[model samples]
Target chain A: SQQGEEDPQALSIQEGENATMNCSYKTSINNLQWYRQNSGRGLVHLILIRSNEREKHSGRLRVTLDTSKKSSSLLITASRAADTASYFCASGNKAAGNKLTFGGGTRVLVKP
Target chain B: GAGVSQSPSNKVTEKGKDVELRCDPISGHTALYWYRQSLGQGLEFLIYFQGNSAPDKSGLPSDRFSAERTGGSVSTLTIQRTQQEDSAVYLCASSLVASGSLNTGELFFGEGSRLTVL
Candidate 1:
């Protein structure tokens, strides 16, 4: 089974609206990271939240992690059409030799 | 290097043929990873190499899939007797020791190699 899974496989929103996606994992992790992919090419790292940290913020992006629930959420505020992309969550742990296990991803479409 | 580089941006091969994909990680990066992404699907782990340590091959799907890193820099992923199911975008990434407390778990990726098996 995949170690990480994302909820709300697809989402649609207009510019200026907020978008949120959640991720769940089955194992303990040292850190959880989020990435965005455009047009199915390379991925761009977005944010990283340590397992010990509950929330993190970077500009308009907010991420929250709940270890007890083994879940995490990414919130995009005032989303623009440029924000449209596939977002993926990855779980990293020492047991995996520092390699990350990625989720299927959530496809987000921000309409102008 | 400016970033991770993948060769053969696109490849097409018939069933039972063999193909090889190449990846050159950012200079000095110790960690390199390979992932496969099928259409409308998430990235699937394939392999990982860190410096001189033995690569972690747990994510490889079958015996026909193999990868080797030379001099801890460039890597090659080979698939023998390719099948249609092997068709996907093969992505390569590199990072600086992504695990430890001091390291941030960020991966820099290269434009993937699109592989098609017919």
Candidate 2:
């Protein structure tokens, strides 16, 4: 079963605009990670935020986690055509042992 | 290999036929995982292997789906009596450390094996 559920199944925006997506999970998580997949192939790790963390940023990617609400959000600023891809949120928790369960993912399309 | 490697990038098989997909994870990585993703869908966990311990197969959808890891290295996922619904891209990932912990859950994925059952 998938632990996380992402909102706004799809999003479209113009270049230089900001894109935001949200993810909600069922169980308590120890950490949350975001990944990007292009062309339906391999996924690349983007950023990770621990439960104790409220927000983090890497490059133009900003991630915020709210353990109390069991949800997280990813924000891509200054979106580029290259940022067009499917983004997924994975939750790692003790209940799942040593594996991270992914969500349905949100597809983002950046139009130049 | 510097990264995870999977063979048979694409495979097509008829219903009732058996197929096997291989994954060679990054050297010395202790954790490996398998996931199945249908077209434009979320990834479904299939299995997980942690070092020499028993694999976690709770995610295997059916008895026909099975996997094995040898010498703590290469792993193979096998399917028997293939069905059209089984067609999907099977992805393999490896992490440097066990997941579910801080600073260790990030995964490196392979290109994946696209399986088509006719």
Candidate 3:
């Protein structure tokens, strides 16, 4: 069964706009990581936020984790056309052999 | 000078025929993983290898799917009697370790092998 589910299956915005995507999981996790995929290719690791950390940032990406809510959100500020891709949140649980359970993902389109 | 690599980048095979996909993890990476992504969907875990420990093959969908990692470096996923449903992008990722710590969750991915079982 899939542990994580992402919201807003698709999003469209102009360049320089901000985009927000949400993910919700059913079980506890040691950490959650986000990844980006271009054109259905391999996924690239974006950022990882531990259960102890409420928020994290890298480049123009900001991620927030709320254990109590079992949800996380990824925000892309000043989005560029290059940022257009599918974003996924993968949850890592201790009982799951440290394997990542990925969400269906959110596809973002940035119009230049 | 290196990252995880997979080949062939694309493959097409007839139904009932077997196919093999290869993955080469980055040197010194202790953990390797195989995942399958169907059209417009999230990745489905297939198998995992961590060092010399027994591989975790719980994610394989059926007995038709099998994988082996030789020398703890290159791994191969073989599907016998392929079905059209098996057509998907097979992705390989490797990480430095298997612990779920904040720093260990980063996974380096390969370009993936696209399998089309017709």
Question: lDDT winner among the candidates?
Answer: 2
Which tens-of-lDDT digit does each residue in B1-118 have in candidate 3? 2999999999999999999999999999989999999999998989999889899999999999999999999999999999999999999999996746556668899999999988
Which residue runs does candidate 2 get wrong by more than 4 Å? none
DockQ of every predicted complex: 0.68, 0.83, 0.71
| Deviation in Å, model 2, residue A1 alpha carbon | 7.7
Give per-residue CA lDDT, model 2, range B1-118, as digits (tens): 9999998899999999999999999999999999999999988999999888899999999999999999999999999999999999999999988778776679999999999998
What candidate 1 gets wrong by more than 4 Å, as runs, is B100-102
- Report lDDT per candidate: 0.93, 0.94, 0.93
Name the top DockQ candidate.
2
Better candidate by lDDT, 2 or 3: 2
TM-score against native, each model: 0.97, 0.98, 0.97
State each candidate's chain A TM-score. Answer: 0.97, 0.97, 0.97
Residue A70 error, candidate 2, Å: 0.5
Query: Residue by residue across A2-95, what tens digits does model 3's lDDT show?
Result: 7889999999999999999999999989899999999957899999898899999999999999999999999999999999999999998878
Clashing pairs in 2: none
Candidate 3 reaches a DockQ of 0.71
Cα distance off (Å), candidate 2, residue B98: 1.5
Flag clash pairs in model 3: none
- Report how far off residue A100 is in candidate 1 (Å): 0.2
